[model samples]
Target: MDAPLPPPLFPALAAPTDRPALRCGPDVLSYAELARAAGALAAGIAGSGRVAVWAAPTARTAVAVVAALLAGVPAVPLNPRSGERELAHILGDSAPELVLAGPADELPAALAALPRVDVELDGEGSGAVPPPAEADPESTALIVYTSGTTGPPKGVLLSRRAVAASLDALAEAWAWTADDVLVHGLPLFHVHGLVLGVLGPLRRGGEVRHLGGFSAEGVARELASGGTMLFGVPTMYHRLADALPGDPALVKALSGARLLVSGSAALPVRDHERIAAATGRTVVERYGMSETLMNTSVRPGGPPRPGTVGTPLPGVEVRLVEEDGSVLDGSDGETVGEVQVRGPNLFSGYLNRPDATEAAFDGGAAGGWFRTGDMAVREADGTIRLVGRKATDLIKSGGYKIGAGEIENALLDHPGVREAAVTGEPDPDLGERIVAWVVPSDPADPPADAALADHVARLLAPHKRPRVVRLLPSLPRNDLGKVLKKRLPRG
Candidate 1:
């Protein structure tokens, strides 16, 4: 028989004192305190099947998740901002035994029907409970829901082995250590802020400070005061770029940081250059999704290119395949193909939806490759540059397969343009006509559609220019700052 695996995801729990394990706003807990608190919560819910977490962006949410993991129960992180219908669907689909939340957090109408457990920082514990009984590596750990662009949101099953493998791989790739103090204000529902932001620090036995909310002043203060790393999406970085010229404190904070990373969506090259110019620090970008925790990242010691997502992490095999399913022989850095990945980091399958699960894997479970549905160009050096989603971002027009991302980037380069989103609408002659939705840098001096279209043609191929351009006050965006292209008005 195989030896039992240790229950705690964090191995260094036994040897810690005085160092903050997690700090959100003013709530702080040391490693010893965390162990005590989590142990108590774990003991209380040791035998629950699957659990739902009211994932508020707070230390309490972190504690509840850790406690669930310690008890070896799969956790479902519920997004706080979800609409009533979306919330109802997720709760019904996952069918968790109970929901966990902080003592003071108010439950939404969607979660009120379920049994509730409140977590307390100063909760009593009999002391550290015995390690949970050894479970199979394939046991489900988290059931994260997708954005449901195609259909209803489906829960992606993530296993213990997958989480451990991904976090460890990222630790090695990022040179993450206990000495590093991570800081971010991302919401707790997504993988970026939850798994990478919260769990990443816990695994390394380091500290994490969540701002409770994001602001340039808040981030600057945290980074200026012992925070070594900052994680954010492009929107947050754009705010940083906008604030750099006036805020000397912000400039000093960014310049002194050990690492700056952008994810959840691609960071525009213009914002990258702006931040770099102000602070002389290159912000690294990584590629990941809820289905796959993290596939690639710019290694800590590697060069931080403006737009590339570096190479695959340790144990992850990433490759590009043509539409016909044949793998590219060698990347020319121009051939666009679908991104396929196979690694321990991959999710088990979608929860209870065997048909959908079966369709995600290429050959079978034995084949081990999962089609990501994202299209990208792979450089010869293995760096992956995402073009966009296969369903929406790839525009087939005039016998040319152009990625909307490139044209969007070109449009953003215009001095008068502040934000840009590109989409393809049906056209009889071109198959799909490129449409650009833009926000002007200055509303009074907005660039004409012809001028902006000409700008893109000059920067890239003429065919890539927008056939129609519409000016909006702002692009529709999600909590993670991803541009919601589907929500754009089709006129």
Candidate 2:
């Protein structure tokens, strides 16, 4: 009676061919091989309501997820490094029918209760490739958990439409085509790695080469061997920047690539300049979160703004809202506001948490917009420059609203400062005084607090200077290189 669901998220697998689809270390799968393997697995798990994947950076992980999509079942990607308590919470919340993992993967104790299915890298399906699933486009495809900075992780229900919309939008923005080949060593748990990295390549009818782990040499080797694009976080770029000076091959490989992208956190302007100076290639930046897949990205042909994440993707509407929920009229480039977005890329809701989900969206006569909780300023050119998170990176001092990201960037420019984080602490006179936690390049001869304060005051406004400075051996960060402000010492 109802119109059939749109074609499978990955149209390349429908009529499998011998074109390369995926490569992880020594393992490789052509479109036909992937279809046969995933189709067979899909037939076996067709009725499974949901499945959990021990998301390892391996070929098996990709096959497992594709199979689940073919079966019209939701797949929950579990971070292989998640703590026991976190794992237990996710397992209980999702209540997957079984767990799919690599043949040699050693899952943690929390996954012991679930039925286990080992995904074989070389096992092709017994018969002809099965047709794609005919399920509703609105059906949940994946249940990815949040980083849970505010509280325990919540499962974000991503729909088939949302995933397809996001990938297609990115394809348009990046000028992605079937002739492209992607290279990355990111983990499989997060959307950047699994969805954008793995699924993106397949949806484009292209190939993806996963390094299993990141390395400058590995990146060079792949890019030299026909890899057109490289996807990495800031940490990975930092390493490449460090390696570029000594490794001409690395520089050559990077220079020859069609695109280099950095996300998960802001790429410091200094690092951007270093890589560009050496390789003549600028690393493109994009902004997104678990709730919304891909909001904005610097287009392939557009100006590669170093600090900005570029304009909103095709079909995505972005708005900057004030504290009182009123939308700002236009971009001034200096006025900071909370980012809100509405588009097909948005998640359906948090799994089994209606109250939380209701609170997340601010709907009005103009449709619902998901609050990103990220603070940014929209440049006059329509590009968005993110300062930081609303909760941790926005600081109010001396009747001024200062973004900690700017000050951190300024501090990073200092030759003495290696890593920096900025936070605001309560003050008797200023309400909230700025604090700078820095890791010096030379701890034995660390820069003086007053000197650093003077440097910041001169670079920015006097009021934006750090009132307190704390020297640290290193900044506490997550796996993705995002600093953990809550974990920093207050005293």
Candidate 3:
């Protein structure tokens, strides 16, 4: 009696095809095969409201998420590296009816109490009975947990409409189509690898080849073998830049890519230049956060410059507001202000935390604008150049507000410096003192504090120069390659 339901999130899956849809390491699946597999799995979990997926960096993880979406069930992806306390919190908060994982995956003690379903990739369902594709678009599709740096990780509820909008907008921005083959080894839990990397391609009828783990060799092999696009964070690009000189295979692979994107954190201008110099391609940087799926990205056509995240995506409105709550009118590329955005790509709210949900929407230019907490300067051409996080990256010293990112970029420009993180410490005279954490190219002979201080003073204002320089073997980073500034030693 009812009309056949429409596939909103993934219309590509409905079409008949034997083309390879997803590949993780040695495991690969065709579109038809994946549809059948997910359909079968979906039937088993149809009535289950919310499902917990152990997001292992494997093909089975992708299958679990797809099955959840097919059944119209909200799926919560648990980080594999989450500790007991964090795991317990997520499990208790979400309270999934069943946990889905690969057969070989060992369940942690926190998840051992829940009923488990092993996602079987080979399972077959009658191709005639596909999961109901039509559903309320506002229904929660995913419950992604935040990093919880301030406190316990809050769950972000992303709806089907939001997911669809984000993917379609990105497709338009990057010129992403079914013909494009995306390659990445990013973890399956995060939005970059899961939503954008896997789901983005699936929505467009494109193919994806996940390397399981990132390496220059793996990247080269995939790109050489039909991979057209690459997605990575700053750390990955840095490694690629480091390898380009010695590894001709890596150089050739990157040169062949149609598009290369960097996100999660700002890719240093030096690394961007290095990669471009080695390969005739420039790595385009995009700005996004967990709350907002994607806000801005460099245009796909050509002439993507370094250090700017380009203009806002279609259907997304971005504005800058000063600390006094005045909307920035002109794009002068100098005045720094907090970034605010409003678009369909935004999440519904923080699951079970109405207080946080309200706070996230407290201040904005136009009503309903989600405060991004990220600070940036808008260029005359409407491009966004990020300064840093408002909480940590914006440093007020000697009656002037300085962004740590600019100083960090200056430090990275030095040939002797391999990596750098700049932070502000309490100073009685200047309000806050600039501190530089340096990872030297040759740790045995680290650059002197005075030389590095002078380097910053010459490049930027004398007040922006580091008051103290501490040499380290490596900077503290998360799985996404974002610098964990809070984890840095205070002394």
lDDT comparing candidate 3 with the true structure: 0.89
* Tens-digit lDDT track of model 3 for 332-353: 8878889989999899999999
Where does candidate 1 stray beyond 4 Å? 1-7, 14-16, 129-134
> What's the residue-level lDDT of 178 in candidate 3?
94
Model 1 TM-score is: 0.97
Clashes of each: 0, 0, 0
Residue 275, candidate 2: alpha-carbon lDDT: 97
Candidate 2 per-residue lDDT, tens place, 1-491, comes to 97665787888888779999999998999998888888878887889989999998999999999989988899999999999899999999999999999889998888888999988755553554655456788899999999989999999999989899999999998999999999999999999999999999999999999999999999999999999999999989999999999999999999999999999999988899999999999999999888899999987656669888999999999999999999987888888899999999999999999888888888831359998889999899888999889999999888888889888988887889989999999999998999999999899999999989999999877998999999999999987889999999876
C-alpha TM-score for every candidate: 0.97, 0.98, 0.97
Task: Report the lDDT of model 2 for residue 140.
Answer: 94
| Tens-digit lDDT track of model 1 for 1-491 | 98766555776555546678899977999988888888788888889999999999888999899888878889999998999999999999999999999888988988888999998887564575434464567898889999887889999999988888999998888888999999999999888999999999998989999999999998999999999999999999999999999999999999999999999888888999999899989999999998889999987656667678889999999988888989977777778888889999999999889888888878876556888998889788878988889999999999888888888888889999999999999999999999999999998889999999899999888999999989899998988999988888868
Runs off by more than 4 Å, candidate 2:
1-5, 364-366
Give me the runs in candidate 3 sitting further than 4 Å from their true place: 1-7, 363-367
Query: Each candidate: what lDDT?
Result: 0.88, 0.91, 0.89
